[model samples]
Target chain A: MRITSETVADGIREQLFTIGDIPGVLWTPAEGSGPRPLVLIGHGGGSHKKGWEVVSRAFPYVTSCGFAVAAIDAPGTGDRPEHPEIRRLVALTQEREAAGEPFWSGPEWPALNETVAAQLIPDWQTTLDALRKLDSVGDSRPVGYYGLSQGGEMGIRLVAAEPRITAAVLGLVGSDWLTETAARVTIPVEFVLQWDDEGSPRDSVMKLFDALGSAEKTLHANPGSHFRVPSFEIDSSIRFFARHLGGPGTASGS
Target chain B: MRITSETVADGIREQLFTIGDIPGVLWTPAEGSGPRPLVLIGHGGGSHKKGWEVVSRAFPYVTSCGFAVAAIDAPGTGDRPEHPEIRRLVALTQEREAAGEPFWSGPEWPALNETVAAQLIPDWQTTLDALRKLDSVGDSRPVGYYGLSQGGEMGIRLVAAEPRITAAVLGLVGSDWLTETAARVTIPVEFVLQWDDEGSPRDSVMKLFDALGSAEKTLHANPGSHFRVPSFEIDSSIRFFARHLGGPGTASGS
Candidate 1:
């Protein structure tokens, strides 16, 4: 692991780092130096690690809960070098979308996601292994994952395979292909759905929520299109993570 | 209105009162006086004004938000005289339950609800009128309603007819008869749904939620039976009401 750059502002310390070929960013309370809870945020499709959705949630987890938060660019996003296959698949899906046709029904949609997940999921596991060794984010602390849309699509697969994640806030994607994978997720979950989401219909999202094998999972559905998720949900997520992971000064994990 | 009994405990002042023939109870912060936000709680079927569900939410609203909370006994329940028609309908529904049959599918269920609503709706409106006149709960403050199950059945009707209520936390019911009434309620709402509820199936409840006209409505669906709504929901409601009605010591309403 290598730290490439560092900056501090608004009581938060931001570090840009790389583990092997994968690039990522981590945020922590500027004043704290000890191990604390960590939340990994996954950005949506076509967005980089520092996308608005990722930074919005990361900033709060750092400032309010005094936790370390991190985000990594996917295989062809952000600072990463472009891949030919991913570019071809994205262009095909976008062509369908531009013609006012359903893009997700085509084979390219799942193909694109599969290609990204094959690389990003392993990248995330490697990132976690390296991050836990750091003094400020030791392995003893509880871990959480927050992702929506494409992030949620990948999160179900990641959380199901990863044992370190104890809680998650995932939703906004409703791929039928993920049913079996979703059933493997037993951690407490807070799933979100957009009532009028065009790409991910409410029923499809609800079906994924029902498939979750967790004993404690709650679905929070609000009105609007996919991108119009109400801001109050951010406040709700803070409380959800606080309750499950415990805050800075509280007893979290062994 | 006559205050037949008064007591103070745990920083909450409880007043048992009667508005004409309606028996009711009111709770408020013991440390403060004068007008504040008021929340009217409607009890479930077979439960009275001070039912466990009502007291649990009322005490928190009073102590946590310093808001005045009140609950009134529906017709043929609590201090009210028995109605032979209501008795017959309940007996029929109980028999269906004993026989392992779906009681809500039969006419007796709607008949029982209609019998209760006939008298209770007018009584509630009259009670609200009298409560708002009290010095401690003046008409100028914003009002909210909390009810579930049988309470939700009646609350949908009440909130629809009464324009004064600005917000409500209602669920645990899916009466198809109330679909049109639910649409008339345009205030902000926090709707709850118990995923595995026997009587109120998740689909039915979701349908009712879908019919609600409130633009700011949110659906919170948790995995549990109808009566097993998690305790955290109570804490969530406190925040919901505080945000909508404004807490005591805050600039609430004119």
Candidate 2:
């Protein structure tokens, strides 16, 4: 469990923000409650905020338990400002990154690691910082991070680079620089993965799960292909949060 | 499992048919495949033949597990010869039943209940019959029915009108038909409901699930609003078939 009974009652915000000039739906709980934790949701490669519908539905699991949820739209996809930050960096890294080893040598997009970390990550951080300022929400401080697929990778990056996000729930995060970075994070982490995720295989993801500096890490593995392998979806993971992220009545330690 | 390791082995043929002469896909297992089970896959409202990606992926499940898996296009949908099936049926039934009643109502292009039974259910049967003739799939029988949303309701009708299908698994079946047909079904059934289903309220669907004629039945509930409510996508359901429909070595009994 990332948060506990103490963190469940105070976090929830209804407003939203634009980080890196990107639109984000911000969810924070009622006021004067306590120091409530916050969560930022990221999406998949071909996904959008609407794609987070299921993930957001699980918000009540956290909110009812006492934490705020913010589902964000990654820059390139959503209505966020067309900042050329990551795009520019990706363009710069393209020829160079593409020329690197097999692990890093994929078709270069407009942004690569260093570029995305420098450009987009800041915008992502800005979204988190904004979450901390919700007037109706407690202290606006967050206790953990959670995301899926590509979002999972983003969450890992958030924790790796951002000291404020102390714990996380990352699922379907393939082993990549994002995950390798996850190793440096000292936060308690729980990873939910599926066998159907043929993308990078569990071994790859496990490598990241193993690298996490925290001794409190746990892994939940379910069978089935990436599509239908798990009988439980994000809903099940929310229950896991009840153990760590706090439950009803308690103030989520942000 | 209805069919287990002790079950005998029988081969079935993959059958192809049409709705009023439209192209369709069907598969029937070998003779010893007794009172064999049946499952008709209905495409989503706007989806078509290629949309049956779920069906094609699950054919092995049907043929192997002693099931008759037949896929047909609803009038104007899929490879089914596009015609006035949706319209003609609407005109015919509105006079006898409430426009809101079964065989008389709901999104049935021209009418609702009429399409549920006459067009949807019948076409499904035709696909089953086509299964019977296949040389490898000897047992020509019907014992189960399955559908999603609109297809879920159609599944209810097949049990009411055709004595062939004895069981069903309906997901997110839209309600509102109880007023027209007593909504009572005598078949053994299982329901997977989505609480906040955007397409239909959980209460509306639960009403339909509740009205079943007190037989052996089970209901599995999941979190998430309407859209995400129906567990898994087309592919997920296909895998569900693998778990329920038996495997590729399906042996028939009929």
Q: Compare the candidates by lDDT and give the number of the best one.
A: 1
Clashing pairs in 1: none
For A1-254, candidate 2 gives per-residue lDDT tens digits of 01111222335445545544556665545453555556566666446654644345445644555565666666555654554765664455455645664322454431444444454567777666655654434454445666767667667777788887766777676655654577687876767666446654766765676667765565555544555434344554454465565643354342
Could you tell me the C-alpha RMSD of candidate 2 in Å?
A: 20.9
Q: Where is model 2 chain A poorest over a 10-residue stretch in terms of lDDT?
A: A1-10
Q: Estimated TM-score per prediction? A: 0.97, 0.41
| Candidate 1 residue-wise lDDT, A1-254, digit = tens | 99999999998999999999999999988886778889999999999999999999999889888889999999899989988999999999999999999889799999999999999999999999999999889888899999999999999999999999999999999999999999999999999999999999888999999999999999999989999888888988999999999876443232
Q: Which 10 successive residues of model 1 chain A have the least lDDT summed?
A: A245-254
lDDT of the candidates, in the order given: 0.92, 0.55
Local accuracy of candidate 2 as per-residue lDDT tens digits, B1-254: 01111222335454444435656655555455444455666655556543654455345545445555656667666655555755565555554455445442436433554554566666666666655555443344444566666666666666677665555666576567542442456665656666446565656765666566634444444445544533233333443444444443434353
Docking quality (DockQ) of candidate 1: 0.92
What ranges in model 1 sit over 4 Å off? A250-254, B250-254
Pick the DockQ winner: 1
